[model samples]
Every structure is written in C-alpha cells, then in structure tokens.
Target: MGTITTFQTTRRIVMGAGAIAKLGEEVRRLGGKRVMVVTDPGLAGTGLVDKVEDLLKRERIAFARFSDVEADPSYETAVRASEKVKEFKANVILGLGGGSAQDVAKVSSILATNTGGVSTMFGIDLVPKPGLKLILIPTTAGTGSEVTPIAILSDHHEKLKKGIVSQYLFPSVALLDPELTLGLPPSITVATGMDALIHAVEAYTSVNATPMTDMLAMQAITLVHGSIRTAFANGGDIEARSKMMEGSMLAGMAFANAGVTAVHAFAYPIGAEYHIPHGVANSIMLVPVMEFNMLGNIPKFANLAGMLGENVAGLSAREAALKAVEALRQLSKDLQVPARLSAFGVKDADIPGLAQGVMKVTRLLANNPRLLRLEDAERIYRCVL
Candidate 1:
C-alpha cells in the first residue's frame, strides 16, 4: 500500500449561474468593507467591471477599480497594482478576469501586505503571512487561477516567467459564474480549454499524485474532453461553459496540491520566450509531452485514455496510452491549436535554449513520473518543433 496524504482546497468555492451576483454578499460575509477590484482593459470595457461595482454599491461596500492588467502581466505591473492597493486602502481584493488579471491581483495583494518587491517572493511558500482577503472571479474557463495557490508574473527584462507558490495565495473565495464566459472569443475558448486539459493530464501523471488528487484530475479530464469542443464551437453554450469552468477549477485544485509535470515545465518557457498565451503554449506542447511521459507510467496513461472517452477495453496498457496521446493530438488539431513550436515562431536553432529553460524548471520537472534531463527535454522540444 502507498502512503496517501490528504489534499487541501483552502478556498470556499461558490459556482453556477448568478454566482457573480453574490460577489457583494460574499464579500460582506467575509467582513470586508473596502475592496479593490482588479481586472484587465478588455473586461473593464465589457461592463463586467461596472456590474461588479453596481453589486458593491447596492451592498454599500466601498470599492475601487484597477483595470490596468495586461496579458502576461509583468513584475512592474504587479508593483503598480500594489501601489493602487495601498492608495485605495483596500481591505479586500477582487480578481475579475482571466489568469493575468487574477495573477496581478494576487501578487499585488501580497506586495501590499508584505514589505518587499514582487521578485523577492518568487517560488514556493516564501510569503510569511496571508495578504489581503481575496475573492477570485474567473471570466475565462481556463488557467484555473481562481483556485490555485500559485501566481505567475512575467519578467520582460529577464525574458522569463516566474511564479510564487504559497497556500497563503489561495483566494478566500472563488466565485465561478459561467455566464461571464459567454462573451469569450472562440480562439480564447480553444486555447483556455486546452490549458485546462493539460492541467488535469499533468496532475494525474505527476509523481506526487494521491487518491484525492487523482479523483479530481480524472473528473477534470472527463469534463474537458466532453465539453471543450462544444464550448469552442458555440460560445453561448452555457452547459459546456459551466462544465469547462468547473473542470478548470477542479484541475487547479488538484494540481495546486499534487503538482504538475513536464508539460507545464516545457510550456512556461514557450510562453515566456514567445509571448504565447499560457493556454495556447500548453495546448501546443501537451500531446508531445504526454507521449514522452507515457512510458513512465503506462497504467496511468491507460486510465487517462479511458477518461478521454477512448475504448481501452482489451487493449494493452501501452496501446491505451498511445490512444490517449492520439486523442489529445486530434483534439488540438480539430480546434486549430498550433501543433508545433515552429508554428508559434520558434526556430530549430532555438531548441537548445528552450531545452535549458525547461531543465531549469526543476520544481515542475521533479514532479514528472519520468526524470527529465537536458537531452530528453531537448529531444521533446525538437519533436514538438
């Protein structure tokens, strides 16, 4: 028998339609009076920001809005946001957009409370205290940033993406309202759904997997496999959107506790270097990385195949694993996700540098079922290229 540790989800998750409407009530319940609403420019103009403000106004909760977040939010931006938190004297922070906005909000909250630059807190569990109370509302059904205890910020000057992982970073509340995702563009739908798929797959195959994590990861995989295409094909498909949102949140919970493996380790460098959206980068690398990792744990792959709706009965574990990779590849191709790094503007000559970056992501690489060294990472990058 293997040792299985209990998994932890620190956030109180409130989901379903009209969940956003309860944002004010949830904040009040948390005893927050002054709050800062963090969001990106696109969502700021979409009236979503106003809707949240209206809810707060009706509840008589004092709030300020900060809509300066950008895609691949940078360290400088986080610092700027932290200043806003201080200036507004916000007692709570509301993250209201996709991953970038959520990440910026989390980092800003940390910086506002902790006395240091954002760079000082990079890596796991470095923050000594919980920051401001945070309520995360994810408008996109991807990234799973709402529930994860990690936040990623880009360092443009360093040409790298760094993360801060701390249980303290977990939102006090995660408000998931699928209605907020209906207006997401089709391209974003495909990219983010693929990201959710990668999160579940990587978590399931992670060496640190526990029974609790496995259940969440498997359910997440099944949900994404069943509904991603429908959501991508029809943005207004509330049912599909709801499922994807749930899957994304579940994946975040699973991976935050159990960790992620090589796909994410590889995906991060691509995102940092190419400025590719995080989800798109994950989609591009997922199939190839999964194929590479399949030999490490055949039974896990077989189970994944079954979860992805492959008929694995009577098939050898190896065969079933291959089927899982094939299904993922087919899904990516069907959704128009870029198949190779080359498609995202990577040159063959750049594989060595990317491989080095992948190897440097030991936090994630350590969780891979199969140990990944520079040579293997290079080979995988070349294959994907």
Candidate 2:
C-alpha cells in the first residue's frame, strides 16, 4: 500500500452545455440573496459577463460586478476583490471566467470571512473558516479552479506565485459550460489546454500519486491528448470543448489530491516575474523538467508515453520515457506554445534567482518524483534560457 490519503473536490459540479444557465438558481439554492460577481476585465467586455448579469436579473438576484481581476492576479487584487464582496454585502461569491478570475474569487471569498491579511492564508490548510457561499463558472476549459481547493495569487513584493490550499477554497458549486469556451482565441485555447494536460502529466508522475488520483490523472491525460488538437483547431466544436473541459476538471481533481510536481514549481517563478501566461510558462518548462524527472520514476514516465499516444512499442522504459518528452515537445510545437524561457525574455542572468523562487514552492516540489537541488533548478532554468 502507498500511504493513507484523502481526496476532495467541489462537492457539486454541474457539467454540460448551458451549465451557466444554472448560475442564478445555484446561488439561490445556496441561500444567497446578494451576489458578488467576480471576473477579469477582458471577460467583462466579452458579453459573457453580460449573460451572467442577465441570468441573475431574471432570477431577481441583487448582484454587483467586480471585473478588475487580472492574469496571475496579485494578492492585493484579491484583497481588493474581497473588499468589493464586503461592500456589496453579497451572501454569494460568483467567480466567472478562467483561472485568474476563479482564483481571485476563491481568495475574495476567504479574505472576506477570515479577517486577516491574505499573505497569512498562503500555504497549506491555513484558513480557519469557510467564507461566503461560492459558485464558480469556468468560461475557459482550463485551470480547473472550480474543482480544486487551491487558489494561487502573485506576491509581487516577493516576485513569486503563492498558493492558498484550504478546503474552504473549494466552491460550493461549479458550473462548466462548454459553449462558454467556444469564443476563446486559439492562443488561449492552446495554452489553457496545455496547462490542463500538464496538470495530469505532473499528477501522474508525482511521488504523492494514489490509486484514485492515478485513475483520474490517466483518464485526464487521454482525454486531453485526444481533444486538445481538435479544440485548438476548431474552437467552436462543442464536443471537443466538452471533452477538454471534462479533461481539465479530471486533471484538477487528480492534482488536487495527488498534487502537481516540479513543472508547476518551475512555472511559478517565471510566471510571477516574467509575466508569462501560466499555461505558457508551464509549457516552456515542461520538457526540461520532465527530462530531469524521468530518471526518478521511469515506469511512470513510460506510462505517460503511452497515455500521450506516443508509440512506445518494443522500447525500454528509459527509452519510452524519452519518447514522452519528445511527444510533449512535438505537441508544444504543433500548438505553437513557447518552448523556451528565452521566449518570455528570461535571461541567463535570471536563472539563479528564478531557481531560488522554485525552491520556495516547496509545497509543489515536495511532490516532485525526483529530489531536486538548487543547482538542479538553476541548471533546468538554464536549459531553456
């Protein structure tokens, strides 16, 4: 037996086309009278927020919109958002859009109730109480923020991305509408899909992997591997979009329990300092991190090769592991995601500091299959720089 483990995710997840239609009803079911709708500025302008407003209006739910959420949002942004929740006197916190918006919503939910600095809530299971009733609607088929009981915020002062891991961070309800993902640009689609894929990849290879998490992760990988290209090329395909969303959610559940490994740890520093998009940052670090990680668990890496649909017939586990890395490289190339840190303007001089940042993400690094040192981190950063 591995070890005693407990798995948790959002208790109620509503998935299908028009899942967003349940937004108002869900809020009402949660006994919410006044609602605070949180989303990013870009999504605010996209008429999706307008649809959300219309739903609440139809239900006669009193609501306010806070659309200032940004990509890799700062802790201050979350503080500001919580203040909005307070100002609105909202009984329900409705998080809309993708990861950033959802993460901000989670933070806002907790910060409203916790009555403490957001920084204090960072790290594992530190929040002492649940926040407002929360509902999450994911417009993009990535982040899995709706399901995962973790919210990440950027700490600009430290130039690092920090995560808040608390059961209270999980939304009371999650609404996944595949149609909401149709309007995503190809770039956004590809990046988010890769993020979803990497979540499963890392979870499958994590030292913390449990049997249930492994089941979730393997299925998530297969779903994403089959659906990502179709979704990327034809963003309007509902079937593809649905599968992508499902894959992302499954990946979220997998990583939520088993935890993601070094790829996320590596991505955070670049993402925080360089302002690389989260998915793109993960993509940039994926190959190098996996190449380094494969040595620790060649059998898992070999499994990844088969799951990613690489023909691993008649190959040794080590050889199949290399093929897994090759497959990720080819997929990144095909999807046109950044494959190197240099593309994000990360310089040779920045490697050491960035590696140092990676070390601070000990929560994630603890799950890494391979034990990594500071020098190893620096070398990994240099690999793509």
Candidate 3:
C-alpha cells in the first residue's frame, strides 16, 4: 500500500520579472506596519537593498534594515537578527537575498515570538509558537528556502549544521522576481541551479514521495534540465531565469513535503565543517550520492533520465538509469562544478569524521530510499574524496 502524504507551501507565492514591485503592497496586505528587512552585505552592496528601500519608501512603510547575514548562517546570526527584530519592534520580517539570508530571517522571525535560541529548537517541529508575519524574496535561483518549512543554521561550537523544521518556518509569502537574479554570476547560477535539481531528484526518489510530490518534482526536473545551461550562459535571459526560479520553488516545495535523502544528509556536514556554500556542497555530493542511490530505485531513475532530456527511447530501464547518472555527471562537468572533495580542502582522512557528522542527521537519512548505514555513509564520502 502507498503511504498517504500531505503537501504544504506558503500562503502565497508570487513570481515573474516584475514581481518584486508587489513587495510593499504584500506587506501592507499582511497588515505589517513596521518591517525589518533582513539581508546580507553582498546584496546590500549591489544596490538591491536600495531598490527594496525605495519600494518601502514609495509605500510610506516604516522599515529597519539588518545586513549582517552571512553565508550558511550560524546560530548566533539568528539570535542577532532576532534581537534587531525586537529592537525595531517590527511587525513583519522581510528576508531578501539567497538561502542564507532567508534562513536568518526565518529563524529570527520565529525566535522573536518564541522562547530560547535556535539551538533549543533543532530537529523537527520544535517551534512552540507562531512567528511574526514573514515574507521571503529570493535574489538567487536556489535553495527554495522561501517555501520550505526548514531553516539550516551552523553551530560553530559543534562544527555542524542543524536544521529547524516546523510549519512555522514557511514564509507567509514567497516572492520570486527573476529580475532580481539578472546579475547572478555564472558560477552561482550553476551551483544554485544544481541545488534545485538535487532537491527535485531526491524528493522524487524519497521514501516519503507521493503522487502530488512526484508531479511537482518531475516538472521541476524538466524545467531545470531545459533552462539551466541557458540561464548559466546568459544571466540576463529573463525567460531562462524565470524558468529556473519557478523550478527552484517547485523543487523546494517538493522536498519540503516529501523530504530529502542522503545527498542533503551528507551536505550539511560538509558545508558546516568546511565553510562551503550550501548549494556548492550539495553540488559536490550530488553525483556520487545519486550514483549510490540509483541501484535502490532503478525505475524511478530511468524516468529521471527522460525528464532530464536524455535520449533513452530504445534503452531498457536499467540502461536508462545509467544514463541519468551520466547526465548528472555531464551537467556538473559542463558547469565546472568541482569534481572531488579535495577541491574543497577535504582530505582522505576526513571521510570518517564526515561520516560521523552525517550520522547526526538521521532525520534526513531515514527518508533515503535505500538505508544508508554508517559504513555506507563512510564509503560514499570516501568515493567522493
């Protein structure tokens, strides 16, 4: 018998080239009087912050800004953002930028209404109360953090990445403006686009996958497969950018409901320990993890080959499955994604430690279609090493 599953997303999702123009009205509709805009220094420097500030000014909305968000945000970052939220007494929190900024805003918004730090709420569904009204805007085409009920924060003291998963983390709105992504460099475009691909593939092959999630994941896969290269090569191509952005959001919703498997399970550890960007870490582990998982679900992988636009008309399921793995490898190669862990400064001796760190994230591993034992985890890390 198939397991029943429930799909959930933000209350509203707005996407398009000029979608960001609706930000002020959306905040007003949410009954926000004072807004706290959480973002990062890089984005602040790029004048995107000025663009958002202008929108707020036009709407006559009172707003405060916090631009200290860091990549792969730390637990302390959440607390600091939360403190600023309280200081401004902001009734709404607007997260602007990529995954890290969105994560900081999500945690900070929740912590503003709840008790204790993000540490106390690690693991699944640990948030005890609803948070202030929150809206998320993604300037990059990855890490659908806008739609997911997940916030990943690094714990510096422990040298590990932890996630806070709860319905409370879902933003009130997910605003995706492809115009905002026009300036993304090719490398970031590749890394983030692949991250979305991983989300869709992992979710489709997850133990918790359902019909609805599969529908969403497959479309996301198709969209990403069709548009990633164009989007990477021509950052200003609005059509390509729009497709990637929508695909990323769908992938995010897919994984949020169906759960991610070993790829993400392994990524958290690598990202936290090495200070790698989350999307890049996922890109690094994606091919090896998919190769490991292929044998566990050949038919699904075969279908994936077709979704990824591989020529599999005359191939058997098993043959097509191999094509899917090859397709991922070729995509990564073409994108110039680092092919080995050594590229990230990880050594062979680090496999065991990475394995041990992965074991801490069984919440994700449990959803792997194949059971990833400790030995298997070590072996996967060693293969990539």
lDDT per model vs. reference: 0.89, 0.92, 0.91
Question: lDDT tens digits, residues 1-385, model 1?
Answer: 9685866775599999988888888999889999999999999998889988999999999999889999999889989998999999999999999999999999888888888677779998899788999999999988899888899988887678888998888899999999999999999999888888888899999999888899999999989889999998898999999999999999988898889898888888888889989888888778878888999999999888889888988999999999999999889888988777887799989999988988888889889998788888889888878
1 versus 3: better TM-score goes to: 3
Using all chains and alpha carbons, the TM-scores for the candidates as numbered come to 0.97, 0.98, 0.98
- List clash counts for every candidate, in order: 0, 0, 0
On residues 224-249, what C-alpha lDDT tens digit does candidate 3 reach at each position? 88999999888889999999999999
What overall lDDT, based on C-alpha atoms, would model 2 receive against the true structure? 0.92
lDDT of 2 by residue, 1-385 (tens): 8467898999999999988878877888999899999999999998889988999999999999999999999999999999999998999999999999999999999988986688788889899999988999998877888999999999899998889999999999999989899999999999899999999999999998999999999999999989999999988889999999999999999999999999999999999998999998998899999999999999999989999889999999999999999999899999988767787788898888988999998999999999999999999998888
The whole-model C-alpha lDDT of candidate 3 against the native structure comes to 0.91
